[model samples]
Target: MALVPASARTWLWHEHAAVPLTDAPPVVTHLAWPPHSRSRPLAALVRTAARLAAPDTAPTP
Candidate 1:
């Protein structure tokens, strides 16, 4: 299953999920960030990686 952070929900919901996977569609899990989060950018990057890693998905800018 692919895990995406909540900050990336907008892009993921609109663009990421349409791409097909080699296997089954991964169950997307949404992760939350705490207030004054230092990990927000990291979370977004991870989410981008998850999307890019899908066999049929294009690399997101």
Candidate 2:
């Protein structure tokens, strides 16, 4: 995968996602935010790495 810097076109590559390790139904295990977002741009970038890595069949939040 390529490292995308801009937010606008970055999401376009997100049209697809990585596969999951399990076949279980998708679920939200947890959600979190950095302290005032001191590091990353969004929670989805860090918190939902697993979800994003897998197929995007699950409904969007």
Q: Highest TM-score: give the candidate number.
A: 1
Question: Where is model 2 more than 4 Å wrong at Cα?
Answer: 1-27, 40-52, 57-61
What TM-score would you give candidate 1 relative to the actual structure? 0.27
- Candidate-wise lDDT, in order: 0.61, 0.53
lDDT of 1: 0.61
- By TM-score, how accurate is candidate 2? 0.23
- Taking the tens digit of each residue's C-alpha lDDT, what string does model 2 give over 18-48? 4433545544545566567766557556546
Identify the runs in model 1 with alpha carbons over 4 angstroms from their true place: 1-38, 56-61
lDDT per residue for candidate 1 within 1-61, as digits (tens), equals 5755545556764546643345656565454557677786777876786676766654455
Error of 2 at 7 (Å): 32
Worst 10 residues of 2 by lDDT: 2-11
